[model samples]
Target chain A: MLEALLRLPPGPVDLTALDPAATPGLDGGGKTEGKAALAALGDPLADLQERLFAEGRADVGHGRAVLLVLQGMDTSGKGGVLRHTVGLVDPQGVRITSFKAPTDEEREHDFLWRVRRALPEQGYLGVFDRSHYEDVLIARVRALAPVEEIEQRYDEINAFEAEVLGAGTTIVKCMLHISADAQRERLQARLDKPEKHWKFNPGDIDERARWSEYRQAYEIALERTNTEVAPWHVIPSDRKWYRNLAVGTILHDTLARMAPQWPLADFDVEEQKRRLREEVPVR
Target chain B: MLEALLRLPPGPVDLTALDPAATPGLDGGGKTEGKAALAALGDPLADLQERLFAEGRADVGHGRAVLLVLQGMDTSGKGGVLRHTVGLVDPQGVRITSFKAPTDEEREHDFLWRVRRALPEQGYLGVFDRSHYEDVLIARVRALAPVEEIEQRYDEINAFEAEVLGAGTTIVKCMLHISADAQRERLQARLDKPEKHWKFNPGDIDERARWSEYRQAYEIALERTNTEVAPWHVIPSDRKWYRNLAVGTILHDTLARMAPQWPLADFDVEEQKRRLREEVPVR
Candidate 1:
C-alpha cells in the first residue's frame, strides 16, 4: 500500500518488519542499505519541494487549509523534516506551531485546548511539531493520567481531527521512525555539547528506558487515530536525508491534490493598465 | 539616504525609514530588490540555506526569538513580504502570527494582550502578520476609539515592543508600501476568482477611500514607534518578486547575523562510540 501511494523510489531501510503489534528490531538489520537511499535523493528533492510549495501558495484561492502533524520521539528528525519541507512554501500562507509541555493553565483544560487555537486560517498551512497525540503517548508512558482516560484520548483525538477535516482542513500526520541506537547517540550528543546541554534532560533517559512502552503507545495512537481524513505515514528517519525527502514528497503530493488556485483567474492587461493609470496621480 | 540604503545590494531591509524625524519620503520610496535576490540566490543560496538549516538542526539548541511585525494597508503586500522573508529561515525555529480584529475578549483587554500570548520562545523567529500596531492604526483610522486614547497607543506600542526586545527578543517591523493602483488590481483579483471571493472585503474599499487617513496614521505610527531595538522597515510592494527578494534577503541576513551556534563544542566520534557502547542497551 505504501509503495503504490508513493511514486518516489523506495527508501533503503527495510519496513517489512514495521509491525504495529510487534516491537521494531535492530537498526539496519532487516534487509536494506539505508545509506544508499539517503544518498540517492541528491538535489532534486529540494527543487521538487519548492515547486510544490509555490503550487500550494497559489492554491490558497481554493479556500482550504492544510494541517501537517509531525510526531516523533526525541531526536527523530522532526525538526529536519519541518525545516526542509516548509522551506518551499510561502511563509505568508504557512504557520508553524510547536506544542511543548503544557503550561499550568494548559494542564487545567482538555489536552486539545492549545492545539485547537493554532488551527490554520482558510488557504494556509499549519504545521504542528508535537500534536495532541501526547494525551495518549506521553500521558500513557509517564502514567500521568489513568489508563482509561489515556485510552479514551485516542477516540477523542480522532473525533477532533475529523471535525477539523470536515471543516476544510486536510490533516497529514507523519510519525518519524528512528532506531533506538540512533536516538541514544543523539541524546548522548546533546549531553556532550555545551550549547545542547539545555536540551538534555535526565528524564529523556528514563523515557528511553521505557522504549518498549512508548513504542506500544505509538502503535495504539497511530492505529486508532489514523483514519481516512488524517492518515499517518511512518517515515524512516534514521537517515535525516531520507526523512526530509519522504516528508517533502508527501507534502508535495498532498498539496498537488488540493491544488490551490492563483489570485487572478483571467489576466487582464487592459484592466491592469487602467488601474495603473488611475493610480499615478497628476502631482 | 534611500539611494544609499538601496545601493547596498539588497542587504537586511534596515527599517531606518520608520523614524518620522529622520526621512519623510522613505515611507513610500524604500527600494525592495529582495525577490530578485531570492531568485538570484540560485544553487548557492540553496546550498547555504540547507547547511544553515542542518547546522540549526544538529545542536537542538534554542536562540533568541526574533519577532517581525508587518503592518500596512489591506493591499500592502504584508502577506507577500512575509511569505518571501520567512521562506529563507528554518521553519522549526520560526513562528508567524497574524493579528486581525480582536475577539470580544481581546477588545476588553489592552490591545497588546493577544500579542503577548503569542510571543515566540527564545531562539525562534516570530513574525506578526498584523500586530498590536492595529490598536493604533485601525483604531485611529476606523475611529474605534477616541483621539487621546489613540495617541496614547503609539507610545504603548513602542514601549511594548521595546520590552519584548529587552527580554531578549529581536523585533523586526515591516510596513508594505503599495501604490494605490496596485491595491486595486489585487482587490480585483480577489473578486475575480471564485475561490478568492471570501478574501475580497468591500469594507477594504471603504478603508481605501480613507487612504489619506490611513497614510497619516501610518506616518504618525512610523514616527513614534520605530526604536533601536525593534525597528520597522518600509518595503516597496509594486513588484511582488522584488518584495519577496528584498524581504527574504533581509531575513536571511538577520539570521546570518544571529549565527545560531550548535550546542556541540566539538565533534568526537570516539566519545560518541564509547558512550553508545557503554550506555546503550541492545534489544
Candidate 2:
C-alpha cells in the first residue's frame, strides 16, 4: 500500500488520478487504531534515535543521517505533523528548518545554498517543513522564474538529492495531499478561531484560486524529481491522524533499515574505569 | 533569592569569591523541592513562549526575542540543562545551537559573523549550548589567539551583544559553576559507564590541569563583558536539580519582563469570520 504512494515509476504523473482522501496505508482499523499504532511507535522511535545520535558522536565520517522534506498546500497539516511526529524524538537528535520566503542575502545565492547549511549533521534527523521544491512548485505556478529556469530546477534537484544520498543521507519527500474542499474547511476554521487568526493569511485565498496551476506544478515535480535515490510519497493528508502515522512509519522503517550501532570506544574501557576509580585525584 | 546570582554590580569580579556549590538562587528548598519547582514552571514557560512566537509571526520588526547563552566547563551539565530546562518550551519557539570547534570557513570570518547568523529570529528563544564566549574563554586560557586579540575580543563581544540587545533581543548569559571535585566525579562516571564513554574526551584532562587559568579567563569575561543590556549570572551547578531550577527561573522571569503579547489582527475579524462562514464557496 505504501509502495503505491511512492511516485517511483518513470512515467508521467497525474495528481488528478490519486484520491487525496484515500487511506491506503492504514489497516482495516480506523482513526482510533491509527492513533494507537502511532503511540506504540514512540519507544522504538526514541531508542533508534538514541543509537543514531550515539553513532554520530562516536564516529563523524561513518555516521548516517535522514532528511525528511514535507511539501504541501496551505492548511495541509505540516504543523500538525511536526508537533505530533517529529516532536516525539529527542530535540538533540533532530534539526528542523522551517523555510520561509528567502531573505535578500539568501536570494543572492543559489536556492540550494541555505539548504546545504541546514542539512542534518551525521546521525541526526533533519526535517524541512517546506524545502527547495518550492523553487519548482510556487516558482512554476507564479512564473517567478523563467520557464527555462524552472525546467532546469527539476534536474538540478534530482542531481542534488543523488549527491546527498551518496554521502549516506537518506531522503524522504512527502507531499501532504489534500482536496481543495479540505483546505477550505481548514482555512475557514483558522479564521473562525481568534487564537488561530495569526496563522490565517488572506493571500491563501489567492493561492487557492490558482489550485489547478499548483497541482500541475506538483505533478511535474513528482514525475521529474522522483528518483531511485529520493522518492516522493503523496500521503493522503485529508485525515491528519493518518498523515502523522504514515510519516512516523516511514521514519521508523528508514531508521531500522539503517540499523546504526553504538560505535566501539577507542580507549581500553577496563583501564579507563580503573583510572577513574583509583588514579584520578579529586579536588 | 535569584537576585544573589545576578552579577549586576559595576565592579571588578573574582571567580574565587563565588561558591560553586551554593544554591543562592534557590530558597531553602533542597533537591526534592528544587525538582518540583522546575517541573512547576513548565506551563507558564510554554505559554510565554507561544505569545513570543505569535508576536514574531504577526509583526516581524516589533517582535521581541530572547537569547540564552550557557557557558560551562566539561561535566558541568550544559546538555542536561538543554534537555530539561530549555526543552520545556515548544520546539517551534526555540532555536538551539551547539557550537563545536569552529570550521575552517567560520575561522575565516570574524568570530561574531557565525554567531550573528545563528541568533534567534524575532519571537524565538535562542540557546547557545556553548557560544562565542569560547573566544575569550578557551582561546584566552590556551593562548590560541594573541594576547592583544584575546583582550580585543572582550570589547568586541560587549559591542556585539549590545548591538543585538538594542534590536529587541534580551540576552541572558549563564556561567554554570561546578567545583573541580564535581567535575572529577562526572568525568569519572562517564568513563565507568560504557554507554557514556562516547562523551568522555581525553583532552578534558589537559583542560582540567589548567582549571585556575580558565577560572581567571571566566572572571575577566564576566567582569569586562557584563553590561546593562546583557548581564552575566553565575549558576551554582553542583546540584543538577538546583541548576535546572535557577536557569528555568531566570528564563521565566526574563520572559515575564519582556511580556510578549498576542498581536492584534490587522483585518476585520467579524468580517473574515462571516466571509469564512457565509461568503467563501468551498469547492
Candidate 3:
C-alpha cells in the first residue's frame, strides 16, 4: 500500500526544510534559492490540470477510496487549492467539507463526528478543508486541553485515521508550510485587495504574533502523526503558484497509482445489433 | 435576458408523470403508470449517470454558470435525489451548500449574503440543498412570518432567482413530490432499523399533522416562482427509482445544452518529430 502511493521520485526540496535554528534570510535561505525551486516545477499549467483531472476520475472509477485532508494555517492556501484543483475534475465524485466552529449538538459529540460523516463513500474522493488534526493543533497551541490530554489525542486521531484507511480509504495529509513573513504578506494582500477583503480577519494579525507557537505545534503534529498510512507532506507554500503545482502533482500521481476500475460494457455489439434489427422500424 | 432564459425548457421531469397525486401503497394514484415515464429516461443507471457527469463537465468547460436549488418537505426524497444525482457528476466542479441555521454574521445581513458568496464561479455549478425559499416555505407553514411578509418573500425570491439566471447562471429548481402517506412510511423505516435510528426524529410526526398547511405553501411556491427563466419540476418521488432517473435526466440534459469546452491539447507532434529527428544518433 505504501509503495503504491510513491509516484514522483524524491527530488531536492526547494526550501530550507523547516530549520528554526537557521538564521532568517541567511545565505542558506536566500530568495534566489526559492526561485530555483519554482523553476524546478515544470511549466504549462493547463496540461498539468488536465492530467490531474483524468487521474482523479480513473481512480474513482476503479472503486478505490481516496481521502485528501488539507490542514494549514488560515492563510495557507487551503481554499485556493480547493478552488483551483476541483476546477479541473468533475464534481460528481468529489465532496469538500469545510469544518467551522462546532454547533451546540456537534460540540456535545467528539470532534470526529462531523468529519466522519463527511468522509467520501466508496468510489469517491472526500476533501476536508480542516480535519481532526485541529483537536491536536488548536488544543496544543491554545492549551485548550491539559498537556496529557493533548498528547493522548494524537494517538486517537492516528488510530481513527488508520481505521478509515484500513476500510479502503487511502489517506493523504498535506500541511501547507508557509513562513511568518509569507503569512503576513498574504494577510496584507487580502486586506489590500477589494475582492479578497472578505478573507481577511483582523484577529489573524494577533494570531501572527504567536506564529512561533503555531509553527511548533504544526511541527509536532507532523512529526508525531506522520505514519505510513497517512504521511504528511510539508508543502512549501511561499509561492502560491508553486504550492498549487506541487500539491496538484502529488494528488495526480497518487490517484494514477490507485488506478480505479471502470465498468465493463454491458452489451455485446452482435447481440445488440440483432435485437435492433428485429425490433426497429424502417428508418 | 429573462426571455432567453425562459426559452430553455425545464427539460425531462415528472418521473411518474402519469401517476400524479399518487401516494405510496395506494392503488388509486396509478402508481404503475410511471413505467413509461421511467422508460423515457433512457439511461437505466449508468447512462443517466454518464450524461449527468458529461453535462456538468460541459458547463464547467463552456464557462457557463449553473445553480441548482432543491427544496421539499420532510420525507420528500431530497436526500434521494441529491444522493443519486450528485452520485453521477464529477464532485470537483460541484459545490453543495446546505443552509441549516444562520450564523451571527449571517443574521446581521439579509438572508442572501451568505448565499451570494456560495454562488458558483464562471464554469462551475452551485447546488442548494435548501435555498432562500425557506424564508417563504418554512416561514409560511410555521406561521413564523406575517401574511404580508410571506407574500413579499415569494416575490423577492422569484426576482432574486431571475436576476441570478440573467447573470448567465442556469437555475434548476426541483421540488420532490412525495405523498403524505409515503413520508410516514419513510419516517417509520428510519425508526424501525437500528442503523437508521439516528436519522429518525420524533418532530417529524408532529410535522405530518400540519401536512396540509405545508402543501398549501408548496403549491404557492411552485405557482408563484415557476417562471420561464427557472421553472420548478414537481418530481414524483414516491417511486425512488423513477425519482432518481428523472432528476438525473433533467440535470444531464440542461448541462448538455450548455456545452463546456475541454482543455486544449498542448503537445505538438510536428515539433516533437523535428526534435526527435535532430536528436537521433547515427549507429
Highest DockQ scorer: 2
Candidate 1 C-alpha lDDT tens digits along B134-219 = 88887887899998998888788878877887776767666777666677777777765555554555566667767777777777
* lDDT for each residue of candidate 1 in A1-283, tens digit (9 for 90 to 100): 3322422123332333553222122243222443343334423433333333344445534446778888888888777777666665666666788777899999999988988989986766788889898778888988999998887888889899999988888888888888787888788777665656545555666677778778878877777776766777887777675566566666766766765544443445455435444553411
Model 2 over residues B1-283: C-alpha lDDT tens digits?
4844555466788766777888875557798888888899988988888888888999843747899999999989888888788877777677888898899999999988889999998998899989999999999998888999989998999899999988888999999999988998898888777777778777777688788888888888988988887889888888898888889889988888888776677888777666555644534
Question: For candidate 3, lDDT tens digit of each residue in B1-283?
Answer: 2222222244332232324343333234343554454444434433333333334333333335678788877777666666555544544446777675677988787767888888876555678878888877777888866889788877887788888887778898877777765776676565544434434445555566677777777777777777877887666667776666556666766765765433222334344334333432311
DockQ of 1: 0.24
TM-score of 1: 0.73
**Model 3 off-target regions past 4 Å?**
A1-16, A19-63, A266-283, B2-94, B97-125, B128-171, B174-283
Candidate 2 retains true contacts at a fraction of 0.28
How much is B39 displaced in model 3, in angstroms? 35
Worst 10-residue lDDT window, candidate 2 chain B: B274-283
CAPRI-wise, candidate 1 is acceptable
Q: How accurate is candidate 2 locally (lDDT)?
A: 0.84
Can you rank all candidates by lDDT, best first?
2, 1, 3
Candidate 1 interface RMSD value: 6.7
